[model samples]
Target: MDITSQKSAEEASGRYCGILAHPTSFPSPYGIGDLGKGAFDFIDFLKKSGQSLWQLLPTGPTGFGNSPYQLFSAFAGQPLLISPDRLRESDLLKKDDFLDIPYFPRDSVDYGAVIKFKTKLLRKAFSNFQKMNNADLCAEYDVFCEKHSFWLEDYTLFMAAKEAHNGIEWLSWEDSLALLSPSGKAAWKAKLASETDYHAFVQFIFYKQWFELKEYANSNGIRIIGDIPIFAALDSADVWACRELFNLDSKGFPVSVAGVPPDYFSTTGQLWGNPLYDWDFHRNDCYSWWISRVRHQLELYDFVRIDHFRGFEAYWSIPFGSTTAENGHWVKGPGKELFLALEKELGRNLPIIAEDLGVITPEVDDLRDSFHFPGMKVLQFAFTDGRDNTLMPHYFKSNCVCYTGTHDNDTTLGWYGGLDTRTQDWVRRYMNTGGSLINWAFIRTALGSVAKYAIIPLQDVLSLGSESRMNTPGTRDGNWVWRYYQKDLSAELASHMKQLTELYGRHPETSVWHEQSGFATLNSRGPQS
Candidate 1:
């Protein structure tokens, strides 16, 4: 798709609804989700459920305890997510090769064993590709490299160097290589050319499999939404290659890190250790790095959600060596200047959803509204104090998006069941219903809101509890490993979702509820005939 020809604000103002299910949540026999049959099946499920959007977490190669936000390379796809089944169909793998693997748990991903097993399989597939001598695939690989060489070459080299150094962080390498000197880079490239090409070939297959899945979804009226974190991991290829783009010290460590100050959620505040961007350097370059980042994402997604949107207006900067986020101070950010540059370069107002959940200042709201980007409202945050909280559905504007629960929150049922009596009573009173139907009630409220888009986490839609939660913000272990079995997505669930979506005018254009006078179209001009 040509992102430059995206719909204007007016054309995009439709009552689109979707589900938030990361690719990892898709069912697979590989012990983790991959770009395989499970992915295509999930897309079919979304189409049957009357959904048009399929929101996903960052698809980058994860690092540092397997968190997607802390990636090895901002531009590289997770090689572990490449589908063995797809490789087999393409004649690069065989079923007999996978027959000896140990049984994997169906309910959750075991990243450790899965990584070991998948890497071995990927190596075999790479060997097969080298020997098969298929001119067509080799030609396609060349085209892929040319199209993505801007980032791919560097990422492939970075991974090759990491392997050469036995997986040590880049900063710990020899001084010349750590600093990315010209002589050091050229020498390493010459010595490790084969390893670099192998990694690049892996990316070629990963992207090929991913685009095939994405094309299937789009053909079925399902749009894929991708995520972009506000900050990059300190130990990333992006920061290592472009040191001047971030606030790194002489030793290539963050001088001042990024985090949020104490908010209503916690007394100590959230300390996100991602490195801070050097806005001055970025502004001097007219945000060319940012433009490339957004451009890369637009190629893979129909819409992009900018996580930690508040940071763009004013970021919380913790002084070097701080133990907690409480010591951070709010620093001014690049703000509208960055957006204007993006608009000029992209030649279109990008479809961005602001994660305006934390301590949002008026400046942040103004920045988000200026571009007419939809801001997010999570329902789980609504009943904390009372039904009158800002996150409540009744207070949402038309240019906003609402969620029953986000990845960071416990599943809706778990949240409601664990709430205090006062909070639970307030929630019940607000909806005028018992708590037995809390998940459905929240889903209905979000869909019936004035917000233009309503998204429900797949866990919430399935009415799962804490066991299905995607992540816990401050924890490092036991995150991003949840999975669902194929049987979990039953015909009954699809039928239920279809009825609710049709009732609330969220179905595709042809299935709207015409008789319901209360059903207003998303745009001011009202429903189509």
Candidate 2:
């Protein structure tokens, strides 16, 4: 509410309970879920559950690995997520296109097979278009290309270059393609014109389908919360196309990468190989790049959660070749200057959530508080240490967003099942509840907390165990593939949750929760997709 000065008091009110499920995890016959019926049905499910928000992982085009955080382009949607069913409806594809459909795993996404099949399907769709060019759709495609030319042109060219070079990393491409020289760029543009236009057409399809689904969700009163990773992957177009904005060498290799120093997760620490930003260059441009990025996310989601929010105050910079984050040093970030620039570019009221987890300090807290962005609280991290138990519900403030567990952590039941006797006892003593019905117990405890927004992962809501857990940090393979059946969303489950939400005065439709007025009273406030 502090960020947006435009909305009325009535508009700024409501305590919300939401579910976290990435669109890729949606149940579908396709190898991966897409922006099609599955997404719409999930919206229907959200409305049925009385959930106001649908939280998702970043939907940007994935590269290197299938990790959503490591994206090819910050602005482009994943073409793999484009539904063949939706394409059929649009007449871009036919039943024959799916003649060789691989039997994908119903319980998990097979990213490899999905990619091959979807790529072939998309190319076939493009080929079919050559035979039948629908005038109206073509006109819309032209307008979309014109409007998004700034990002689309570079993205399409980048994708074509990737294809031409047999999908090698940008840095390894030929000098002309890597540096984008004047004559070289012109020659490639002419030669790869067809390939580039194909990529752009795919983006147009992604944009059209995604916005249509978003509109459906909005119409049903379900708001979306999207994520923004703090740093871009070194291999991403965001860094490659704008090499000057990152701390990169002449060959586009990062001088310093981004990661945290040693802590709870590992003694060596998690060394994320994303390129560190050139804050001085960004500052010189008045943070225009960041403003544009924020603007794009704001348009996509009702609320944007900035992952690794502490990075804005101070980031951990690791030497590019380091194997461990222990060798990293903390470097100062752009801080409030960046967000103030965002506020000016956007509006007074910015809908942002700060993923204020990990090694945090008072400076980070101050930065988050200054923006009035809600910091996150996870229940699984609460009982890990006695003195460090700031995550306990009793310590929670109403302005924060609380979760039973996040994607990085195990599901609630999974976490409980893995806990030792002492920790389990501590959890019991704290909640005044035994091991029985632990998942629902945590759900109830989260809803009943002072926090204004309580969001539980879909796995916790369904009482699933480790097998259903979405992602485990520090792993490369066998992650980001969990899927839920349509039948998993039972009426009984929805009723149970709605009862708890209403009982705790946490139903978003009723009133907004706030710290100053307390949960019983009323105030207003405001992540990641």
Candidate 3:
């Protein structure tokens, strides 16, 4: 859709809802989820349940801790998310290759095992692609490489060198390579030419499968909402390729790191070790890096949610060696100057959502409103203070996106159960519920809000507890591993969701929900054969 049509639709269809699920959480037999049958099936489930949007975490390749926020490349799609089944369909693999599938737990991802297994499989596919010498396929790969050369060249080389260095962080490499000297880059490129090509081939398959899946969702009237973290990983190709744009020491260590002051998620505040951006340099350069980043994300999703919107106004900067955020202080950011540059380059009124959740100030609100980007209102934060809180439904403006709970929060059932008795009673009285189905109560409240869009975590729809939580801020391990089974998306469940959606006037195509005529029986293809 063009920018004009998108604005028109936003004005017309003011109420919509969707589910927040990362692709890795989808059920699959080959360990973690990929852009395979499971993804398509989930899309089918969304359509059946009357959801028009599919919100996902950042789809970039993950580094340590398996957190999507710490990405290997700001521009490249996750190679691990590529579908081996699709590769087989493309004659890149044989049926025998599937015979050796390893056992994977149904409820959580085993990232180490999955990475090892999938990497081998991807390598096999890449070798087959090279041996086949298909002219048309090779030509398509060339076009993809050339089209994305601006970022892809650096990313593939980064990965190839990482492999050569036994997956060590760039700073630990020889000084010349660690600093990304031109001579070092040229020498490594010559030595690892084949390895670089292999990485490029993997990316080609990843983008191909991803766009195909995205096309199917759009064809079925489900627009995807993707995520973009406010900062890039310190060990990422973005920082390594453009070191001068970040606050780095001469030895390539972060001079200061990104984090937040004490907030709801943590007592000590979350110490996110990403290298802080050099905003003065960015402003001097007209934020060319940010412009390309936003433009690339816009090409990937219908709307991109910028995590940590307040950071653009003022950011919390902690010393690089600090373990906690206690010593951090707020530093002024580029503010409107950055957004104005983005708008000038990518066109006015970009389709973006502001995650205005943490330590917000009036200046931040003004910056967000000036661009007309909708900030978020999470229902999980509503009842703690009272009805008058900005997070409460009654206080929400029509421009915001409401959520029962975000990925960082506990599932609604889990959160409600853990509340103090008095707070729980307050919630029960506020929602006029007996608390039997607190999850559904929160969902109903979010959908009924004045916010233009309402999003629910899939775990809440299933009424799962903290065991299915996606992430816990400030903690290092055992996050981003939640998964649900295929049977979880039953036809009965879809009908119920559709009924609630229509009741809230959020369903676009259906004005009435028929109990007698329930949703169609599920014929979704199960886990990979």
Candidate 3 lDDT, tens digit per residue, 1-529? 4442464356464589999999999888888888999999999999998899899999999998889999999999887788889999999988988888999898889999999989889988988998996999999899999999999989999998899999989988888788877887899889899999998998899989999999999999899899999999988998888999899999889999999999899899999999999988888888998988888888889899999989999999999899899899999999998988887776777778999998899999999999888999988899777667878788778988999999999898889989999999999888878887788878888888888899999998888888999998888788999889999999878877776777777886864545654435422211121
Task: Give the TM-score (vs. native) of candidate 2.
Answer: 0.94
Candidate 3 has an lDDT of 0.88
State each model's CA lDDT, in order. Answer: 0.85, 0.84, 0.88
- What is the C-alpha lDDT profile of model 2 across 1-529, one tens digit per residue? 3334542233365678889999998878897888988899888878876788889999989986688988888888989889889999988998877788889988899888999889998998888776785899888989999988878888898999899889989989878889877788789889999999899989999999989999999889888899999898877777767888999989889999988877666778888899999999999999998988887887788888999999999999999998888888999999999999988877765788899988999999999999788899998888887855888889888888999998888888888988899889888777777676577778878888888788989998887899998877777878898998888877767766655566677666644434543434321110000
Global local distance difference test of model 1 = 0.85
| Off by more than 4 A, model 3 | 1-12, 511-529
Best by lDDT: 3
TM-score, one value per model: 0.95, 0.94, 0.95
Q: Candidate 2, 206: how far from true, in Å? A: 0.9
- Of 1 and 2, the candidate ranking higher by TM-score: 1
Clashing residue pairs, candidate 2? 3-348, 3-349, 4-349, 14-512, 56-529, 57-529, 226-528, 226-529, 227-529, 305-527
Candidate 2 shows a clash count of 10
What digit string (tens of lDDT, one per residue) describes model 1 on residues 101-176?
Answer: 8788988889888988998898899888999979999999999999999988788888898889988998898887
- Please give the ranking of all candidate structures by TM-score, highest first, separated by commas: 3, 1, 2
